[model samples]
Target: MRVPLRDTVAVAAGVLAPFVAALALLPLRTSVTHTNLALLLVVVVVAVSALGNRLAGALAALSAAAWFDFFATAPYQSFHIQDRADVETAVLLLVVGLIVSQLAAYGRTMKRVAVADATHLERLHGTTRLARAGGSSADVVRRVRQELVEVLELRSCRFEYGTLIGRPPRLDPDGSVQVEGWVWDLERQGWPEGEIELRALVHGRYQGRFLMTPAPGSVPPPLEARLVAADLAAQAAAALDEDAVSAARRS
Candidate 1:
């Protein structure tokens, strides 16, 4: 898939801003102490984090540290720093930048709900249209499962609605098992056959489930992942309902 233009721009800005700032301030060598100069790099780190990911901040931090060591410290115009204090200050710039970047990353997670909602909304609309096209319950479910695998980029996705797609019913605490009753699992292993799993529900009733292998080495947060699964499962259930009603009308 083509990468978004906006993301490319954000990453570019994050990576280049530190070097640009360091060069812009090079003429101020007489006025700014090396220690004070390092602080400006920390600001660049935060700016990069705000604009992009933690990796971007780390890149900014490393770039800024190099500039600090090369131009701002005593024994200037070289890679080496003579003073112990200056070395520590340089290290602190990298450390502080990394920590702040993490904080910023966590802060950005606040948007996860909005992002999840939008994703589910789009899928729901698409599936509802597919349901209107009329397919058997099994066929609708297969399409839904395929949609889940594609949209979430899972390793695999399997769904079963009161039939054998795999083993017997393994609720793993079930969708209605929790206090507020939304699908969840504690094992972190996706339910049926994947690293992550959740029960499917239709109007708060158990209908089926999806076992999804999370992308290797990556899984969404538990709550977010569950909600995403719920949304996918709900789509499957809706499709199944549409199929059943269509069959009934024909019969």
Candidate 2:
């Protein structure tokens, strides 16, 4: 479990401040026994702040102040303050605790944001790599399926072209060609097990449909799949147009 940086710092300060105060007051030689005891008291405050939340920090601060008043002053073991300085010291300790906690919380937020940005950059890089791999529509499909299975950990994937009757031929599960307008079912073994119908786009035209069935109870397909699908759709459309042009020339 990640400890929020703010909580850690706050706790550290709470425990350290009293001992520091005692040390600073040591030169005065006001009360050797009382100062030593005050150092131990501050240590407890620090420990409490580290293990608890904002409420704990506040409680630790308050307890430290009370302990100091009761044991450190000339009026030993009493809450009465002998001077304005002592009162100010108690208030400052509480303020320090609040400040430390705030800084720690801010640090946690920044860390989370940084992680999110890194993930976005990674996806962009993957898409760019896919585009640079030139190939026929079937090759593109194969490459994409392989990438999805390997990188995205998808179980299976395929592309279909056109409507059942009028669509272009399909690249089957085994990577073989079949009649146009056929439905290709893409399946995976785990979570998010469902199917989506896709119509092939050729040269800005719809060539056919593609579909996939996610594994039972699998998590929903991530956004990356949709982005990849869009890219494949564009490639499919271009491939169909090329095929049509080739057939016309032959005829």
Candidate 3:
């Protein structure tokens, strides 16, 4: 379980604050007052156990035990566990801390995972909405690019058409330059040290190839983007086939 920075800070503060407070109350110490102080240290242990995970809680408990022994107990400041009862108390404190921390940590992990899952579901829902909105293949392609640029904050995107013949076209469709595929300098983007090509296809016919140059040192395209592109290609092919059938029937 990854602990958030804020939670880690809070837990550290929880562990330290009581010790600092106990130190401040040292001037008022007598035999009876010292016993109360020891009890207060135990409270700190319990609190830390409740708030942290097993490891953190156990550490906190150990820290509390050591502080109590060194600062509050008799013979005034030494780690000598002279009595059997003191050893038993320390053992009990450690066990309690471990159990509490484990439970708390598990709960925190589950909550975090649930939240992440919910956010992913929401994104999926948005993508589905975009896919369902009806439009011409070109329009749909533009919309997909726009969504990716806006939501994913990509530097640039292009769609290339695959060729049926020897080589693919190395340019974007005439009017849709900014919104479509264009030749891009791969070296500028520091991509895998080789030339890459993008091709657009509709109904098994080659449309064109687009070259993409992502920002230098940018993360690679995600699997989701590739999947979305595949889906868009399939949709465009179907749309084109339907249009061709209609045109043939009219002729």
Which predicted model would earn the best lDDT? 1
lDDT of 1: 0.66
- For model 1, how big is the CA root-mean-square deviation? 7.6
TM-score of 1: 0.53
lDDT of 3: 0.52
Q: Please list the residue runs of candidate 2 whose C-alpha ends up more than 4 Å from where it truly belongs after superposition.
A: 1-134, 148-153, 162-193
Backbone clashes in each candidate structure, one number apiece?
A: 5, 24, 8
lDDT of each: 0.66, 0.52, 0.52
Q: Ten consecutive residues with minimal summed lDDT in candidate 2?
A: 184-193
Using TM-score as the yardstick, the better of models 1 and 2 is 1
Writing each residue's lDDT as its tens digit, candidate 1 over 15-121 gives 78887888877888779887778888788878787777766766777877888787788788788988899899888987887888778766765676578668767
Clashing pairs in 3: 53-101, 54-101, 160-199, 160-200, 161-199, 161-200, 161-208, 162-200
What is candidate 3's lDDT per residue for 1-251, written digit by digit as tens?
A: 23346567656855685567558656755644544665666666556655654555666666766666665555557777676766666566556545655666677767766775565455445544554565455665565445444332346766554443343323222211121244434224323322233345554565444344444455444334434444444444544455557679999
Candidate 1 clash pair list: 189-195, 190-195, 190-196, 190-197, 191-197
Strongest candidate by TM-score: 1
Query: On a 0 to 100 scale, what is the lDDT of residue 44 in model 3?
Result: 69
RMSD in angstroms, all models?
A: 7.6, 12.6, 10.3
